[model samples]
Target: MSTRKDSLKFTMTSRALKLLGQNLYARPWSAVSELVANGIDAGATTIYVSMTEDPATNTGTLEVLDNGSGMTEEDLEHYVSIGFDKRAVTGTLKSSRAPMGRKGIGKLAALYLSNEYYIHTKTAPKAGKQFDSSWHMQLDFMTDADKEPTLREINATTIPTIHLNEQFNKQDSGTLITIPEIELKGLGTQAFKSLASRLAIHFLKDVLPDLKIYFSHQKINEDPRFKEVEWHPAYGNFLLLSTTKSHTYVQDKIKRKVLIQSASRKDSTTVETSITPTPSFPLNDFENADIANHISTSHNSNTISGAYFPDPLSTQTYPYDLKGWLALHATIKTTLAQDNDSTFTKNQFFSPTQIRLYVRGKLALEDLRPYLNLTEQYANYLEGELQFDLLDEDDLPDIATTSRESFDTEDPRFTTLCILVRDWAQILINERSRIAQREKERLVKITANANNAYAKRLSQSIQKLSESKKRPEEVIQEVHLGLTDNDPLEPDAHTAAKEEYRIFISHSSSNKPIADIIYDMLIELGALPEEIFYSSKDTVSTDKTKQFKMLEKQIRETITDAATKICYITSKGFCSSVYCCFEGGAGWATRAVSDYELITTTYAHKPDWLDAGLQTTSIIDQTGTFTLNRETYMLFTQTINRLVEHLNVGRRIKQEPLINSILEDKIPSDYKLRTRKEKISDYYNPILADMITHAGKSDHSAEV
Candidate 1:
């Protein structure tokens, strides 16, 4: 047998190492988070993330120091190794904090922030030892790039120096990572401020109670925006929606699934496992048990299991342990209105109207307005946060994007959450609409009460006018037929009054003779000329002369205005005139046909297009004469008077009542009128008889 030393070694390409440095972290803040996570994994109770920048040179250095169970020389070797699993060997630290660093790639995160980084660590001393073993190692990407670096080459090349000096006693147990040359030059005071906020939100629960995080020697709580992160209750403002009597929803013990892997002699397989119902216990107990079993099992025959249980306090069923409150702005309108001058206008991300989502106390997503698909009106009235711990469960597949900026929409869990959000948003929208309707009804009732009181006051004024020897018509005008300025009927009464007109007359210029007669009649009946819009009289030309185009425009406006009545004078000329037809059509289009009437004379012939149901009055008989001679004039005057009354004009003239009495006397009590066709037949019968007598005489003379 050949005596040869053969040892297993892991190696990686130089390109792979370079890629790791470049792609391990997306943003400088994410790199910082990785460092913080590492400290948390190390059971750090307090972590300091400090930055020193020289604006003159645009250079900066970042250092993260954690007071935790740090690393030994052997631990330092494992830390530098790529793809090494930290939890597999050490498990959770003594502080019982869950390990945040799993893949051991968090160390490479520092490389993304700088080309060079150094680590100094001192492990906790064993029993009977006065001092701990301190170790320091430096990683230079610049030097590593120059060689064909391998995992073994890189790890073996660096030998951490053991510090035996008194300086080692300064820190009991902790680790410090220093990046002397930050590659990202954009990180300045503002950037660090933003980073501090991000840290406070991401480690919202982790950094509280025992763990304290600081930036540039200032605690996160010192920042005004993040001050709440320190004192913020575990459910901060979440339960306030209920006490405030706002619209809210809370669901817990939602069903969720996680993928489990099992290995058999033939092949390994994966299966979806749901939480099994069990007695209430700490969630960490399940996670720790699963992780411990996973680590100890053989690679070829490993198995994993999951547990599920309903929260006894949960009131609603959901897909995950979701608990939150959605508050409507209407419920807290008074409070929000007070801050309207300051807070309402600003489009900040953390506005109260926004929805925040947290996974295990870490804000996984903020401002979920886009996903909620709420209208601007409804969205502004909503605000709340929901906490779902299943999203942060270690064994569950990562649904969050690489940058952790948002959750992956493609993830089933995230998609389900979005669906729930959409449902809640719809519910809130309907509720808000219902509340608004109630408010509208309340205002209407108040207005109605005021209107009744106003009407009573107006009635007293009208009675006074009647008692003052005013004419009946004058007293009617004082009565005010509809709502007035102080009527308290509608809020827009003045605007509605402005659009009102008395009459819109649709007549042809060829029929102007008759139309003018009617116009004069209306004026005689106490109708104002301004109120009666006969296009020929009302419209003025742009050229200071009456033009048809200008007349058409004026006619359109007059017809569109709110009018008491639209009268169409139907004559032979009226039926043939295109402008007359257009005016009539416009009247019907602008207002209902019931508001208009048709007046026919002997010269008028009903058009085929005219509806038979139209109320029409004939002023002349088929002989082109007044129907009952002088009685026709009285009937026409009364018809015009009735129209004037409908126009709400305040006066009526006493128009010769004796003439109406005489016309009624002339009509025989037992007489019945013949139809138009029968009368025409009777008139032609005598003439036809005479023609027949003359024809017979002429024929006899011809025969002789």
Candidate 2:
């Protein structure tokens, strides 16, 4: 075979070059960022970016002026060459700063914002020259298509103009790039803000103290200084995790005997597969002492393991040089706005939850939450920034996408970084969960104690009522009124109860006997009869025509005023009676079943409409008598007690006489009510006897 040497030439159409320039940057902010980055690379102490708009023409001019080492005639020629590798040829800037421009295509970024641009630069004089020389290059994107021009052919037509002395004096050397005829259609006031924010993040870690980027915009008759872009703090008050030493994992030797089986022989073998700790940078020594302690004490082993990032490059090692902070603000305040002396709207930069990644002091990724796979609730409360300079090493493959908005997730470094972030996020989430649970338990304990104390005071008041010489019903009524004055059980409950009655007794007229008994029990337990609205006792009109009206009025008043209702579900005429059904329905419609108690006697059957799981009191036995079982009695008493407690009734008794005594004779004279100390015993004796006699009878008929 014969080999022939041939030379090939690369050519690009003007349209293709224009498209390439347009696609180089996704947003105007990104185009500006490229220029600012170039300024930083040139060791510029101050870079001024200004935009001037002409409203009548609807166009603007964008200018970037940097007081840094400028280009000479040779440099100008190289700058105009497309696809030139500046970093490879020049190594670094004259100031010994690492050059940011690599492919030398950043200059195309200007075409993204404007069609015409001009560059004026002056470099220091050669060895024996008395003054520096200046050069300028003008580029017009609206080139004639008929010319079929190449980048080299176009540069040949516009030779760099040279001057004897430095142009735009006061500085030894500098570059001034002006992009005229800037299309300002999409560039509004917010564009400047977006640009500032993006630039701040781009230089967050690497921006030198002396480097200042002043951004400003000017409109007709407007002050240019009014809306100057200000630097804002991206993250604030976060737990800092700065690295003092870099550590890598290594395999440690450990002696261990293991059983090994071979085709010819079986024997014990020694194997080593353990990790050794490094002395200079301990694998377990977190830069932040607090974080180290937290990880050590954490109960979740998974979280602890996740916080440890192992070296992807090493077979048995963890990478530990990355430095940053992990912060969780259950409540986020805009630190960036405060630092910038500005205000933030809801949908601005720095969301409530964000995991930003920085490389070489520049933000490579804004949000890693999507990659973290953390719970949305917890992720929404997190915000942090991590800097890993190694990711930006020139030798490493470029992981950033063309847009430079984020890194390629397929990259190992990116994947590992996401894993590390997820682990740290998990640790923070677990710690937050622990804190919330502890707070919840503490609050529950406090509430329980308060309820117990409230119940005790109430019980004491009932005991005092039993000691008073006044009738049991009268003392009960007073206590009920006092308790209903204001509910002390819960602050919000108290506010809600203020306009409602304490209790509403819903029962059939045929079941008045049981209702009377329950009424007396409630009174004894410190409930007011007035607060206990029963249609039979509450309605007062006697005339036949007015009787229905009065009953209707009482039902409406009771239903409207009631906070809790007690339904006596008896089988006799309870469910069949329209009035009783209405009352029960009204109560049910107004409040939840939890606010009412269902007391069913022996004759009562559970309704199909009623929930089977509702809190119910079944006191009546098969004999139609209230159950004498100690547990049953306690259950009944406890139900009433709960009602009393919820109503916030007074814990003290007041002895007073009834205004009218016409029904004094109706009260049982043989009711052997004793002093407060013996009231429980005396009250139960007669009640027990009546229940026993009722049980002993063969008759199934009962009035209750």
Candidate with top lDDT is 2
lDDT of 2 by residue, 504-572 (tens): 677777666556555656665456676677666645666756865666786666554433455555555
Model 1: per-residue Cα lDDT over 137-199, one tens digit each: 334455664455532223312432122112323668887766665654555455665666666
Give the runs in model 2 whose Cα sits over 4 Å from its true position: 1-8, 90-92, 126-168, 205-207, 226-320, 332-353, 442-704
| Candidate No. with top TM-score | 2
Backbone clashes in model 2: 8
| TM agreement with the true structure for every prediction | 0.43, 0.50
Q: Total clashing residue pairs per candidate?
A: 4, 8
**Pairs of residues at least 3 apart in sequence or in different chains that clash in candidate 1:** 275-307, 275-308, 276-307, 276-308
Local distance difference test values of all predictions, in order:
0.50, 0.52
Q: What's the true lDDT of residue 74 in model 1? A: 64
Instruction: Judge candidate 1 against the unseen true structure and give its global Cα lDDT, from 0 to 1.
Output: 0.50
